[model samples]
Target: MLCLRSRTQDAWLQRAIGATRDILVDHAHCERKAATQALMLLGRFPDVTALVEPLLDLAREELEHFELVLALLQRRGWTMESLAPSGYQAQLHALCRKAMPGKLVDLLLVAALIEARSCERFKLLAEHHPDAELRDAFGGLLAAEARHHAVFVRLAGRFDDAEAVRVRLDDLASAEVAILESMPPLSRIHA
Candidate 1:
């Protein structure tokens, strides 16, 4: 049997749940945006069938996750509200150099980093959400996001030279830190 945390921990959990709910709503929007971007990239990289298929699958899954989040919001009687766009994504996109293989590498690194961050956030939410249902939902999402991060990392390796990829990943990581630091307290997801 799963033992729940102590009362003190449960208090903390409630706060975390509220934050997680906010994140879920914002993440639904992010997933939709990502799916659209992936589809656009597929059109551009038609020659890479092997690379495109996994991304296609990822797009489908992200859409499904979006639907799930929408349903959850509906159940809670929460209408989706417009939130400020995250600087994290904008910063990532800015790092995407216009050059050939460089663009592809940058995209992959950005994707991986975003997914990894999402996974980390979800794990934190899962551990802290007061409600068992919300905890379970976040736990499942954390696992999926971890997988998505791995997939992007593997795909990046396939498409780009190792040295170039490493350099860009380092650059992107620095950009990510700067973007994250500059943002105001972004309620769990949206700034």
Candidate 2:
């Protein structure tokens, strides 16, 4: 199951659907950012042998997803472009502790939460989006997102004990609920 304490609001879904082009652009950016984040983690912890290969693989998959999203945008006669920040990720990352294991644990859990939320949103789009092709595309991404979520959670366990990770995950998930609740309805994922 997703390690989320709350669901994406229906109103946000409607906004996303209503602004499909904007959402598609935002999704492409998200995928690119996801790839960058994986590489960033690898850069941050090169000595952590366990993180190297998995993070490299994640970066590759995320880049593939970015390409896929870009193709989707091209097909719809829309090009990816910069958009304003929604602050969802910033808010989530701000909750992380500054220390070593605590920082690592929080970063992993935060990544997991983002993947969970993306999976949830993709599932919703697959089910409810009006365009059949869009639905199919979103459906295709669900598995990868879910897998990424699981990967991050598993990686977190490598940094800390199960009980500590679980408690921190719970706490972070609660904070995530508040972050999502406070966000305004926007076409961007995690908005």
Candidate 3:
């Protein structure tokens, strides 16, 4: 089940529409970072053989998305900018526990939550954004993000007990919901 809270405020949409270039810049960097994160995980957990193939696939897809987003920005005459800090993601990481025992579970839960939230945001934009191209692009990404979310959770089970991971996933999801609600709304993607 999708677990992210919708961006209930109309203001967020208005912001996104009014500042397409800025938002696209952030979105592009987000895709780049997502790929990097996947690669980093594969590097960090070489012993966890189960993570290799899926993480590599994830990294490739995310990099592909980065390129697509970059092209979209270029078509609009927008150049990529230095990424602004993502407070929302930072808050999520702060919630992550160190790997003493639950490290793998926590990391996987965070990955799942991020992908789930991104999927929700894409669906929202696909349905509501006025720009046809963007709407279609976002719609196209839905399936991939859903797959990414599932991959992370499934990998988590391989790392630990499935039932325990499920419980932790639920708890982390609730924490994510709170973080989303409390953060100041921004025009950036996933904010």
> Which candidate number maximizes lDDT?
2
lDDT of 3 at 14: 77
Q: Which candidate leads in TM-score? A: 2
User: Lowest lDDT 10-mer window, candidate 2?
Assistant: 180-189
The C-alpha TM-scores of every prediction are 0.84, 0.98, 0.93
**Candidate 2 — which residues are off by over 4 angstroms?**
none
Cα lDDT tens digits, model 2, 1-191, are: 79989877788889999999999999999999999999998888788889888889999999999999999999989998888889999999999999998898899899999999999999999999999999999999999999999999999999999999999999999998888878777778888
List pairs with backbone clashes in candidate 3: 99-103
**Cα lDDT, model 2, residue 147:** 97
Identify the superior model by TM-score, candidate 1 or candidate 2. Answer: 2
Candidate 1 residue 121 Cα shift, in angstroms, is: 0.3
lDDT of 3 by residue, 88-157 (tens): 7888878877864478768877888888988877787789888999999889988998999999898888
> Least accurate stretch of 10 residues (summed lDDT) in model 3?
1-10
Runs in model 1 deviating more than 4 A are 1-21
Put the candidates in lDDT order, highest first.
Answer: 2, 3, 1
